[model samples]
Target chain A: MTDVKALAQERQQMFVNVYRGKIPTRIPINSILSLEACIEYAGANQAEVLWDMTKAEPIFEKVNTDFPADTPAGGTRRYPSFYQILGSRPFVMSSEGVMQHPNVQGMEPEDYDDFIAAPYDTMIEKIYPRLYTELDTDPNTKALILAKAMRAHGDEFALLAQIGARMRAKFGFASIPSSATTAPFDFLADFLRSFTGICSDIRRYPDKVIAACEALTPILIKKGKLPVPSKIGVTSIPLHMGPYLRTKDFEKFYWPSLKKQVEVLTEMGINVSLFVEHDFMRFLDHLSELPENTILRFEYGDPKLVSEKLGSKFIISGFYPVMLLHTGTKEQCIDKAKELIDILAPGGRYIFNTDKGAMDMHGNITENLKAVIEFVREYGKYDNPDEPYDLSKDPMPPAEKIVAEIEANLNSKYYQTWEQYRANHPELEGRPQEVIAKKIKKLEDDMFNFIINLGS
Target chain B: MDRLLLLTQAISDLDEEKVFQILDELIAENPSDEEVQEIVAACQRGMIIVGELFDSDDYYVADLIFAGELMSKAVEVLKPIICSRKKDTIGTIVLGTVKGDLHDIGKNIFKGMAETEGFEVHDLGIDVEPDVFVAKVKQIEPQIVAMSAVLTIALNSMKNTVDALKKAGLREKVKIIIGGNPVTEDSCKRIGADAFTTIAGEGVDICKKWIVNSIA
Candidate 1:
């Protein structure tokens, strides 16, 4: 009989190999599907199956069967698969056992006021009660209930309980990846508050805003306790407040709160991983204060610049654009993968992945996965190639220079000439500038911050 | 000349040490409603700039969140004073995330923005049940009902909430508006909703237009 421990060890070895810039037998694929796709597959409407786990399970099982891979034998195991987990809402799915929502819903202050005015502790407080009341009665029912509830709405629940004992058994001590925490501002804007409200709040109630941040830390810390895998440290996705505010605003509202979270998480020995989603081309310096071995995930960020700035200090993942899977042909995907591998793989602290998940609309997933696998097989070997790649030698111009260029161009004679040229044409009157000079300037500043921080 | 511009720049800079100082100066100087409006407009411009920055990867999520917090603070300070004389009611809205979901970031943001856009919003927070949603509509007598949910599982909760409202004879009284990451136009229709938007900004616009068309 095959040795289970050996196989598990082998899988870990392969993962480490890829992480260490060595080619593995095959690239690992971790594909995530949302509940929408599962609903579509089940031929159900949104309402009929959302509340009932039993109703959504058949479709989930079918999808899993269609895309079969051996369930990991002994590490942290996620039961009911990702699909079942995502589909476990308390509301019933549509008659066809599929998920769908025709109207998007949002709340205002009045809505919250009305809710708080009412008796219930809101929906979050009712989880345990509902689960105990509605779940089936069987010896194994507790485990099933836990699994079903987690599958449905577990992101907020205690993490350890969500991952059943069977699943928890698969992990080794210190084997899981670290958790990443977002700056309070990013957490609220991206997850809690609306972008517009947050921007306005910064000016109106800075103290209240800071107080809110301080208040949330305990809640987040409490939530963080549920998911600390023994071997793998907690890593959070710190999606910085980008595309919403200026750098100075970031320095004030964002950094202070994030620095606090990082301090707490680091002090607890958890790893901080950041997904710098927007232009960090200039903001890397702010991140320099973070402890060493902090994991960095750069999306749409220049890899050359990231390596130059923070490469030696952190474990970096990603730079590949997920959109490439949908837009690029197989050959193009392969070429791009090779290019990334050539540039990012030479260093020991890189892992290959797209900047973000392959979104639902993305196509040619298999081809893209194949491209990544093929590139790793062909070029990821640790054996020194005839021509060693050196990232330090090819430095890009400072981000400030780029920003300056853009600022200069915004007021350049050509732009003025164009405005004058178009002024006579009534058809073009009141039209906004076609060239996004202001946007470029912002990008330049952000990038410059990122680059300058690389040296720090 | 550009009081609004100056205020907005100060807010964006987030000079905490100097924020209160500048705000004190502005309040003491007693800027006119027009001046306040201009500053509000500047803040709006800053939001658009921030949005563009986010879209173009010029700013990070943290920057947007920080700036948003600052902007919200500034607006709060001016809002009470700006509308002291006027009792303008654009419309009333009842909003909540459907039952079995605890995510409220999207809902809270929408609530704040809706208020800014001149709507009286009743925010129900997260995991609201269908019957409760209907009860709120009847009690509040809102002209519009907005629902939000971030999880796919809660999609049914949204539909059920609408269905319950329709059954309770309250659906015709309100324009049902839905917004969230998982929600789309098709989903809105399938769930028997009148409208849907992906972001809070669009939700405000949808609510505003819906009220206008209803009145028309």
Candidate 2:
């Protein structure tokens, strides 16, 4: 048997080396294998699988072992063994055949008043009781059972008694530390608020909304400090397109807290990974403020822009849109891969990955990864004699010239007013005109500021 | 003086602290609901500007969320008086996160918006069971029953809740709306939901339309 500890050490070293600007023998491949994939692959009945975790465990184990291509290897591979243990606690399926895993504990309280009013032990009493009971009954036995299940899966699984020990040492356990879970903001907005309510609140009671977020941050950070079984830090923040708060609003509510969270985790030596879901190209400056070593995993944002602006500072994990994986042929995938490699792989701070998870048929992950590997093998060399690419070839005209263009565009009688411009674009009808004007002014102001700052 | 234009300027600047201070002076001066709504429209303009900034790459997600926070605060000060003479209850909404799903941020945001729009929202909290939903519907006789689930696995619970509501003979009486990360319009139709919104802002229109149409 291969020494599990030794293998883990090797993988860790490789990761560190890559982060430190050293190229390993081969590019590391890491992917998240959804339980949905396992169930679909195994063709197991959902109800039956939910009833008995042991039954599902074998199937997950089988699929992982058989489909090495699908599984994320190298680094710490925490397989899908826990699915069987958690069982099905309801909220498993939607009317549309979409599967979901609800938290065993229900939604959190709505406002700060509700949150503060609730008992401190509510989480312990309502949520973790059963898990604690099981632990109390046989702590070592349970750990051994989980360890055995992990070991049976081969080199992919590494069992660390507590996942965020390193983070705990650094951050002192005040922050929530669950690497595999979604961020509290996403959990609240996507799962709890529904769409309309969150949107309305964005307009109606924005302060209360910000207060609620502020209140949750400490609690979530505290939860991140928990002891769990795993190596390698895991944290996920889901970015959603929204009811549309303007830039100033974003700076106030979202940036400070997100920056704080990233800073806390990175300070404690936790590998921070963010998954950007929607188009957030507008907020590059805010994103650039994150800790330098943070790993940015983009789902929808443009790769070229990301690489140019943020690539040098952090690890650029993905830019391959899932749509390409489905619609494009293997050759097309390879071409795209080569293009991305040529642009992003320079300076050794890039890791090839899909824009998002290989969810549904759109992401033919096998072909995609294969293409990435092939391209890396062929062209991902640091010592190759290739000309350094210049990103700022066609720079924008001077700020004054740009402002002139804006004025000319605004003045043309073709559209009487900004409202007329919005009317021409029906999609813009739903959005408020004042908001649009404000955004335009801010952009113009920022451009002017940039120009001013450059002169200074 | 183009009150709308002035309001828009205030909103665009997100001069909430300034707006609130001005609002306090206005309230002391006994401003009417129409005047407040006009100002609120201006605040809405600020939100729109931010949204555009987001689209044009002038702002980021954090910027938008922060703007959302500011807008909500500004709304709170104006909501009471603006909505005072208006109908006390546009409708009651019994909402919750499905059982086993611990996400409630979306639900809370929705609740805040609903309340701001003069809807009485009874939030059942996250990981709510179908039985609990049924019980709440029976008690509240809510005009709408909204459900949220972030995870795909929790979607079944949403279906179960709807099924339970139907079984309890409460389905026809209340409109069922759903939203979340994994939920799509097709999923809403598949789950037998009355409507599905991709974002919380859109959900308000869906609920309000249902209520107005039903009442008419």
Candidate 3:
């Protein structure tokens, strides 16, 4: 009889082969499931599961037991309960089972110099007080929070290890990818600057931004180099704030620290897979400048265009618009999966995941997601993953008409908003000032001038 | 340059010193209500350009933020005089980030822009529950109910707020606009919001156009 370890090794080898740029026997699918979503699936109350380890263990084990056997094991973010124990409220509990992040500004703009001087220390000293306010003023309070956090981490690690072993024994799936931290640039962009802060800093204090991004690099390099390939072949760093920058700003302020972290990780034989957020169409030209053989999971880009450009250099995955899982028919989802496979599966080195991933059940229509994954698993066989494949069995709906109809409906809503506004307010009844139009044109000119120093 | 033009350019340059200088000049003249209105419009013109630069990706999010700060500061200089008289307002807006969401960069920027456009703004801060919003609506009787949320999960809370208002029989009494990263026109319809905007400046414009059209 085959040993379960042998069966687990069999699945592990398939992931290893695919990561090595081989097509493998068939394409592997990632569940990309959030823990909250997993908990919800098992009919557990999310509130109870967050803070209670005993309640959480059974639910997580059940979730692991229920995950489709074919899905490659992956990691989830740190538990909200652990963070709550640390006296940090980074995420507030949404009405849904999941938690939503609050905009927590860790670093003040004035603290840039202090942060640049000692990155880790600054985060602990200056940033933590702001983020975890309860731990700010009282030494005893901080110590208590620290004690709780330590206890929580110990419990969590033990629980996870047990669940992982069970999952491997039961389903031949051991979490293959090592969890890692982001590059310093991302740490600043996500943890410190937040979205609005960094975007402003790029222009307002461009040099300071550069120095701060670089300051985080040594720390990032340290974290990025923590794992050996034998432990986990790939280190996942979800990319943020990169696509939002203008191409020039990316070259100047964002890319250097990121490039260094990836280089360090690569020299150590740990491959880096970037789950690219938003669109990176603007930065496609700069792909060759970075380390090659990297994995890119794009969120909202055109897959065909990505394949056309960086497909040869990077192992590309994703751009399967997850929104379709909710909005489109099941057949459309299948058609889309086939369309992406046809575009990206050629010449090897592609894995398909949800565009932005399905965080919870509501993230995508349940049946639609399952059908697409099952179809891709079966149809994405190496023997005929490519086209001149027949799509006659399920053809796409008229794309233009659907788009036009959606647009028309959205357009009518705008008019309706205005009409309703007028009806709601019976006080004033007059046209918009004619002088305001000229002011608008002048404002546009001034704005154009300020941006990119247009005339210069 | 004319005082109005100088005011616009000062704001465009984001030179707070110059803006204050010009604002003092305009106020020293004890400008008429209509002139004060023109001065406000001039400053708004500059602020609008700053917003446009942000939209076209010419200026950064940081620039939009600085511009908003500049507009807010400039508005404060004019607020006493403007409010001292019986001035015209586009309308009142009750705005907040919904429960369980604390993202307010977009909301804060929208608040500055809405105020500059002469809307009386009441901000309830982040993580506001449905009852708080309902209470604000009942208290202020605002013409527009603006909600902002960045998380997709918060969309459920936004919908809940709408449901609460409907149950309270106050849904039709005000206009609801949802704005933030996770919201879309589809989500707007799903949540029973009259409209949605991801852009802060555009949200301000929507308020102005909606109120203007209402009166017209």
- Taking the true A–B contacts (Cα pairs closer than 8 Å), what share appears in each candidate? 0.26, 0.11, 0.40
lDDT of 3 by residue, B66-115 (tens): 67777777778888988878866779999999987777888998888787
Interface RMSD, model 1, angstroms: 9.1
What does candidate 3's lDDT look like per residue over A56-146, in tens digits? 6666566545545355333344556656765665545655545556555677899999877765556656776776666687788777775
DockQ of 3: 0.24
Runs in model 2 with CA error above 4 Å?
A: A1-17, A20-25, A34-64, A67-280, A283-295, A307-314, A319-349, A352-456, B1-12, B29-88
For residue B78, what is the lDDT in candidate 3?
84
Residue A169, candidate 1: C-alpha displacement in angstroms: 9.3
Stretches of candidate 3 exceeding 4 Å from the true structure: A1-7, A53-75, A94-97, A138-141, A174-177, A226-232, A384-456, B1-39, B60-62, B76-87
DockQ of each: 0.12, 0.07, 0.24
Error of 3 at B176 (Å): 2.0
lDDT leader? 3
What is model 3's interface RMSD? 3.1
Local lDDT at B213 for model 1:
86
Chain B of candidate 1 vs. true chain B, TM: 0.87
TM-score, candidate 3, chain B alone: 0.90
Q: Candidate 1, overall lDDT? A: 0.55
DockQ of 2: 0.07
Model 3: how far residue A259 lies from native, Å: 1.4
Ranked candidates (TM-score, high to low): 3, 2, 1
Better of 1 and 2 by DockQ: 1
